[model samples]
Target: MTYSSDYLRSLVREDRVHRKMYVDPEIFELEKEKIFKKVWMYVGHESLVPDPGDYYCTTLVGQEVVLSRSPDGNINVIFNRCGHRGARVLNRKRGNAKVFTCMYHGWGFKPDGTLAGVPMKADFPGGVLEERASGMVALPRVKSYRGFVFASFNADVEPLEEYLGEARRGIDELTDRSPVGKIEFAFGCHRYHFDGNWKLQLENQADMYHPAACHASTVGPDGRQFQRRAGKEGGDAAFFTANGEAVVAQTGVRGFLKGHSSEASLFDKEQSGGVWDEYRAMMVDAYGEERTRDILKNRRHSMTLFPSVDILIAQTSVRVIRAVAVDRTEIEIWPVRLVGAPDVISTDLVKYVNITHSASSFIQSDDLEAFERCQEGLKTEGAEWFLVAKGLGDEVDEGKGVLFGPRSSEVGQRAQHVAWRDLMGA
Candidate 1:
């Protein structure tokens, strides 16, 4: 039941994971080149190119970057090709281009990607249209911790907050739930193209154990809003599992690494843990309760930053998993508009993160039908190896991540496929 390459690198045994590592295709092209081209992905935020020539177009972990925001405001990213005939220069998905027209044989770029005018400026008189660091290939590693943003075709990784360990405290409890601590992404994204393969939606967002049996009675088990207001108008079912008691006190700071790891609410406090009382009663009416409890309990956790960030900080949401193979997957769902919530809780957290975590979700259609029926029964052949030995030897290495139990424990999907088989060596 193993497909060579040393039996798929011995299907990772110190705590299983070998359903052909989610049905291989050369282990999904070595996890898109050693874990999404050497990490730091999440590319698009800063209110998605706010103003100037604003741009957005995505894909990193699948190439094609683009990101832009030029015309003085700065923020570029680049690489949507067209370095003269490499074609595809901003093929939509976002726009406001003051200049990037490379509809082949016309060139012309600029807006921090230089080479701005090229329509026969003496038709190649001495032929050098902005060479030296020529532009357009600009991602020599981009950063942006707070307003999200990230990019890297690997110019030597590790810097995005030391590659976000302990999940940059889930981007500092999502920009301290914004009392101008910064958080923006004004209602736009809802994208999802899942048949399933993007690490099975990062093991269903760090495996929250299918919310009491796959979103039981539907996502409102006091996890907030799961209907049943009978005895006098709502609240019970232990008030939606005690409104996820800080996601069960974040399964004791869930851990794991090699790419990244996380599991459980990392501090949007308030399980009587003091400091998150309705985000300190609306950040004490705009920064007061000791600077709003040091802006909602001084940050310390939240992460999933390996093959492309997932730091969902109690729902500020940044989930991105773009594995364009093993069939098809690109669930880029981005949403972080909390900044100081309460426009009725940011319009009910933008309709509960675009209707219960977007991509037209019915609770995301039972996690896309259990990751597309486990990738169609591991693409049949009487199914050969798919065991991730669920909490094997009862997972508890605790050197960083293993102690597994609830929030649907497969222990963050076996510490994310043993850090995706040691960064795809399997």
Candidate 2:
């Protein structure tokens, strides 16, 4: 069934969207071509490939690609396939390799994705292939901002910063929070998948209404007391509550252009009179008292990068989203390191990632179960539309592409679908 632009636009409304958008195979295919490939999607952080010849294999919109460093100190995004039999040239997840040798055939390529050598080259038909043209294909555009790398297959796409728009502030705030104003992606990551669309995770991260309900078991009464006891064991009463779950505000949710949204709350209560005092003092020394106060006194929640990545400043975690099919999606969460900050700050950040967002996390487990259940419910043909009308009539339009409303409001979700509709040509 081919959906016309009118039909696609009809599926999305200001207050709701049809469930078929999440469950239709044809729609998913359209999304891959129109939404994912045409946008600037995150590839990796430069820290992941610190040295020349270091490469990390990853995927964008289900297409396998590699992020590698060239000997001339440049990062290159290369398609993982060998030019010769179309086999993958780099099999391992990551390594420092000067050349990639295809196991299917002895074809080799440089770390910068140039053709290096091909065994039995003399036996090839005369003039059948050219070595220079046989190198791995690179994406049309690649750019890095504040250490993060991104690529786009569309040569005519907007510049990276312009594509980011107001969402760039989230990244800036993230890195600026570090004492040295620099950060690094962590060495380890947590990867997992769910039986649902990729957009569910993006919406769930910024959906403030669910924490008390979906994460009731983790941040609820019993869990709070348990956490208190755990904190006591560690000789810190504010360990878990310092910029933790209960500190995030319900009214801080703000929607941005290009399907981006974020939650921001002043860290007023969380950064007072405890071990956090020492951390605050350290930040004060690095970046004057006022800036340190602003940094430690604020908590910025996750910011969604339209169709792919989510930046969670409070947790120092970057989540990469991959849509595998109509009903399946995978995610990889990488905790980040704030360079030159107090050791405890980094330790607490990693701790938050483990307990809240990792595969084994108490919070993520509940969310995953909810996602799978939502998928099951949508599969029954019992409903046509999913309501995002929670706070529809009362959105406050702050100037400059930012909308504010109750956390339960669908403003962010609506902004997301609006971008989806435009990109999908609906």
Candidate 3:
């Protein structure tokens, strides 16, 4: 069934959205064409291809693409299809390859996606294999900000930095945590899928209301969770212990334009001694005492860069969301290493990611169950809308496309649908 623009706009209201937004397969296909293809979707980081010949294979909106560094030291994102017969060129996930050759036909491409060689050149006419037609097609627009790369199919899309707007501050908070203002994805990643709509994961990232209930099993009677294996206090325990309703009220949620949003930090409790103190001293040395205090004091727990990526600052990780179908979604959780910080800090970040996001971990497992349940419940024919009215009118518009409210507010979810309605309507 084809949905009209007016109909799509009507599906999203100020306080709720139609259930068809989540359960309809047609709407999912429309989303891929309208939102994902038109916006600046994330495509790995520059660190993934540090060397000239290094390349990493990834997907955007279910289309396979390659992120490679050319000999001239420029990064390129090109379709993984072969220029000859359209077969997949690069099979491996990542490698240092000067040329990517197609197995089906003896055609090769340079790292920059230019046609390198063909099995028989003289067989075709001059116009048959022109320069433009002989090479893999690159996405229309590609840009990098602070080492994070984004690509868009629409040539007329807005500049990446401008699209990010105030959300860039959330990214700054993550990178600024490092003493040298740099971070890397050296710790690999945890990739898994959940049986639910892609928006479920995105909404849950900024949801402060569900953790206390969804993840209650992790917290014990003592109000502590995931005690450090090093026989020490603080760390993840500090975050889990403060999951009560009263404590959550202290934190807040901030929504930005283009569907970006962030959750205020819940683990900024002061650290007095041990490795944390040493880490603080390192930060103080790099950035003076005043700057370091500001950095550590106002950390953002998580930030969702609409439709694709989530930056979990407290865990030092990045979660990439991929929609497989109307009901199935895959997620990749990449742990980040803070540059120029104590080795223990990086190690602890990885450990936290493993404990919180790994497939076997209780936190992610619980959330996945909730997502699946939501998916199942939405399939019933009884309800036609999903209410997102919590803290609706209470949001304070702080000028410049920013709306914020209590930590448990559903304002962030509403902002997502607002962007969705506008895009789909367009």
Question: Which numbered prediction scores highest in lDDT against the true structure?
Answer: 3
Give every collision pair in model 3.
none
Per-model root-mean-square deviation over C-alphas: 16.7, 3.8, 2.1
For 66-97, candidate 3 gives per-residue lDDT tens digits of 99999998989999998777899899999997
Model 2 spans > 4 angstroms off: 120-132, 220-249, 266-278
Q: Report the lDDT tens digits of candidate 1 across residue range 1-426.
A: 324455555677765566666766777776677677776777867787888887888877667878887788878788878776577778898878798787767776775677777676676647455553444778878888766778777898888776666556666767776877777777776676767577777766666545555655454423544312111221112314344443432343254555456665433323322233454476677777687666544233246766665766545567677788876887766666666655545545555566556866656666877788878877788745555444445456655433544433566666666666665553
lDDT order, best first, reads 3, 2, 1
Report how far residue 279 has shifted in candidate 1, in Å.
Answer: 9.7
lDDT for each candidate structure: 0.63, 0.78, 0.85
Best-to-worst order by TM-score is: 3, 2, 1
Candidate 3: misplaced stretches above 4 Å?
A: 227-234, 237-246
Candidate 2 residue 395 C-alpha distance from true site, Å? 1.9
lDDT of 2 by residue, 264-323 (tens): 542334444444566567678898988876765455556788888888765677889889
Better of 1 and 2 by TM-score: 2
Task: Tell me which of candidates 1 and 3 scores higher on lDDT.
Answer: 3
RMSD of model 1 against the true structure: 16.7
TM-scores of the models, in the order given: 0.36, 0.90, 0.95
